[model samples]
Target: MTTAVPEDALVLAGGGHSHALVLRRWAMHPERRPRRPVILVNRHSTALYSGMVPGLIAGIYQRRDAAIDLRRLAARAGVALVIAEITGVDSTGKRLELSQRPPLRFGLLSLDVGAETRPSGGMPIKPLEPALAFLEAEDLEKPAGDAAPFCVVGSGLAAVEVVLALRHRWPERSLRLQAFPKRLEARVLQVLKRHRIELQPADAPLPGPSLHCTGSRAPSWLQATGLPLDQNGRLLTDHHLQVEGETLIFASGDCAVIRSDPRPASGVWAVRSARPLAANLEARCRGGSTRPWRPQRQALQLLGIPGSAPQALALKGHWRLGPFRWLWWWKQRIDRRFMAGFQQLQTMDSIDPDASMACRGCAAKLAASPLTAALAESGLRSAAQQPEDAAELLPAGTAGSSWLQSVDGFPALLSDPWRNARLTALHACSDLWASGAMVTSAQAVITVPALSSPLQSELLRQTLAGLQSALEPQGAALIGGHTLEARHPTPAPASLGMQVTLCVNGQVRRKHTGTGWSKRGLRHGDRLLLSRPLGTGVLFAAAMQGAADAEDLDRAERMMGSSQHPLLEELLREETEQEELHACTDITGFGLLGHLGEMLDDDCRLQLDAVKIPSLNGALELLEAGHCSSLAPANRSAWRWLDAPAGKAGPRIHLNLEGLPIGGSRHRALLELLVDPQTCGPLLIGCSETLAMRLESLHSWHRIGCVL
Candidate 1:
């Protein structure tokens, strides 16, 4: 359910350590949360723990170990998560300008977006995501035996760890550390020498690829906000962590410095400031006073040494500890314990006990049983009578042309408004495409969430833009549409409360005498081909429970957003004219079995190769773990219609599992996937073996079964 955004919503901009901890606190202690809606805006779905960066760089930890799933955290905390790059902040207007969507207005705002590193000649080590990507790409391109010296520039512990990490990642490559002699501690210098890393003057010219761990500075975009800044351009905040002279704005982490007790930019300070930041943000939201935060002057820093037998060094203002193996273990424990705070959150499920989590997208459609019953009672032709994807609109005396029309929609599936609308447009167009017609025009009926007039307008703008993007690419014009506000807003993230419905019109070219492709023309021995993989249903269901992997969700979103025009074009290519496609339909709210049931003939039964069914990555595992779309049970009813003899109903479809393992976890999972409703799912086409083979050779289409 989507939560309505009030006029006084609190926005936390950036998923830095401090903001992440604030969310954790709210998750663990919901009673102490702010009264108003809390939203977290970040550029990515995962936040990297800075404390674990060295270990991650040295290959001591997996990427998941160091990354926090912001989506899960926000869901657990009852906060909305918006994944988008923040381009600028408007202090006077109380708005945050985003790169892709419209500007977001906030009643109270907090900034924990860590500082940016601007290196003169090398990649900046801050903003670890892109930096890590660059490093990985460089490693892949450069041979292991390359003698080129990789350089790290800085005298800080971060630079030293990065240099050592390079040594660990590429053992044969020459590694160089550029730091001033006066800035380096004796023990640190000794560790560098022991690792065979050459130390050069800070000003030394780098001969190869280099990384800069130079200290933090405010992001250039923040400068446009006209906020108070310190010597290094970091935001200036009061003792209470509130932006100086601004009561409604707060700042923390490396991005801001408390003017009363300034400290060096470090992850330690970021962690230490979380508790106080959370308290102050909550206090400000409830119309209460905030307390001042006084941080300790010195923080203990632990630096890990990467080698066969790892050790760590601890440092304070003037005190230094030994590089012992115990220290390394201790550091690992701290990092793991910190990460466990997020990982362990999986135990705290947010799903309501009394109500099942109704899915979004196509899975959210009304069940067929009730819809068919209602249509019959109203004396209207049911879908069974008109088994085609789109309705044929023939003008009274027109003999040369006929129009195909279809309307489809659902509540927003993704938090991003643009993406959700774009996918909706694609899903709506699939009907015409399934009928072997190209969309020529479309009209939309969009319902924006209940918000201020300005916010509603901004959301509508994004939705329209997304819809237009999908239509314009197919040479389809968006003629006109209607807009309204939702009566009751459900509580979820981003623009989940918004809904979109599109009515598409297309022209069908006659093949000899037939009007267009239909779903009823299946013959014996006709093979079934699927254009894309399945499992969007189960995957999204798992996502609502915070159990889906970020990578899997990312891959699923890419597939769902991709246009199916290329596949449609390929199927209708001139070379394939000799072999006709018997039937076709886009698998949607009705799962594969449900949609396939509609294509069956009285005497024919489909023989499916269970193992040949394509599923998205991690989908089978999710299914095996008992995650399924809410509509699966209703969709499973379609099994009754499968393999039935003429004038008779059979129990289920016949599976051609000759020697494969039976009743195994994977087998059951695959069976369940058949009834798992898809959102913008694949196109299922029936054709002869000759055409099937040709389509399968194209790589996108997979022949999953055949009518027997």
Candidate 2:
């Protein structure tokens, strides 16, 4: 979320080339950016650079070389990155309707969503992601000799590049191109013949897997917006890239056509329009006049040749050049230089030294000291006093059954609303799982961003769906809930402005013996087991700074979204009945050390093998680089409770770090991770050493320490 004062929100509806370049420009020149919340909505976290897509397909470039990391770009530009499919636009309402989330309201909007290619009988290649997936799948499913002939349909640069790429990928496979002879230049046809690709009429029947690059047309969803479109179904815009007769709306890239000075839909024009489009959008946001953008009538196009040696054809208007090796080298240089701008981000310094970037997720929670102080001041029972993950409901239910309830939530840690809600649900249910309770029912208090009526309804609908998805598997029902709007709304890619708190009810059965596990009984020599790795706090904190790797973030999210039910079931299996769980609690906002302190008895001490502690990938590296959750400092205060002097206010829970060299990088990282707050973190279980060994063999749990 942005700290900028509430103002008109500017929404860039797509991660097209123009928008990506615009974001890069804004990152470089912050002063030129409008002082408003800027949001970029797209279907994926990365955008394929169209210019290098041909190279990528031909194996001249890797996927990473051709794809732009929108997450990092948005972070650098201070823009909210929303990864969601856009369904339609409410032009009159100035809102973008999304597929799974609410409509995004905007004071100013820009459409660089690119164009679509309708395929008559083959795969459409307009949307690069799906096409790439298709190629990869085909390659895996069909071996070289068994594969059918490859075909490309179209009479444009995209089709030509694809056909050549196919030849490079499978040299022995027969390749065919279906294109109108009138649309192709004589020289181009000659090159196709030289490459041994059969050229047929545009209406020729396709064989095997056909790749359709049949030019560009506006996405069908745009027609529902009631925007003025040219004959080809592209949004008609004036010279300044603004929709005709609409001040707040703007359009560029293949999805739009300039009415007065029309240019063919191409990546060249998209790249060229970036500067003007960005300037115009900023001007509109500032309530200033927009400048007209006059693009060159002809653009230089470099066509790659599929061969052992690198070669390319340069075309501009009526002028053409040979498939020279120098041209390919030049093209590679240009593409790399263009991509480098995004790779090397400018270092950002805080404008206010007093303010620091606070970590999101559970790390955003109130510190332990103030929270305990407040609870004491309000005459409420603290976690230390209760020593249970959930509160027990009064009176027994049918038979000897009792009830347990817990509520847990936090600000959005992820940009995807559905996934965020899923993570939140799993976190809320963790309390019940810790107490060996089966979740029965839950009620949610959902606070969404202030938006139009339709948007609010949509947001709530998606949120509830996410909640139901998580609870359904556990035999839990969503009985009732309340909804409200945030007092101050900020632009999010999806539901960052939304916060969900679930009051979960669970049932715990007693077999006429005793209650379920609580955080009070830790026998001496009992082993401490951690269900999962630590460092979600540090990873997410690094993500906000664009310092986290994409793979690491994806892994972390997968871990967070995984339910703890399976682990709970394994622990409660009859085979493990001989070994009892003595104490249990889920590590949450408070770091592991902070939460573990509650489970300690006055005479108990913990001897931990620092080397045995598992950490999420890159978490330690990030911590070593001075990145840590904002709550780490406050959570460190828990150390004072450990080994406190005699007569001091102490539970006397001393912590001894084993196998750790003091003042070393690894040691420092481990210490910070111990205090790093976690959202949907692991469960700390106290059990016998034999039980820990048995469980570790059965699951991924690690034995971190032993009670003394």
Quantify all predictions' global Cα lDDT against the true fold: 0.83, 0.80
Give per-residue lDDT, candidate 2, residue 553. 74
Q: On residues 204-291, what C-alpha lDDT tens digit does candidate 2 reach at each position?
A: 6777788898877888898888899987789999898989877678899999989999989888999999999998877776667778
What C-alpha lDDT, on a 0 to 100 scale, does residue 692 get in candidate 2?
82
| Superposed Cα RMSD, model 2 | 6.4
Q: Mark the regions of model 2 whose C-alpha exceeds 4 Å error after superposition.
A: 1-8, 141-148, 167-207, 245-247, 347-357, 365-382, 395-401, 407-426, 436-535, 554-584, 590-676, 682-708
Query: Which window of ten consecutive residues has the lowest lDDT sum in model 1?
Result: 1-10
lDDT (tens digit, per residue) of candidate 1 on 34-89:
76557789988899998898878877778888999988888788787777899999
Candidate 1's TM-score: 0.88
Q: Per-candidate TM vs. native?
A: 0.88, 0.76
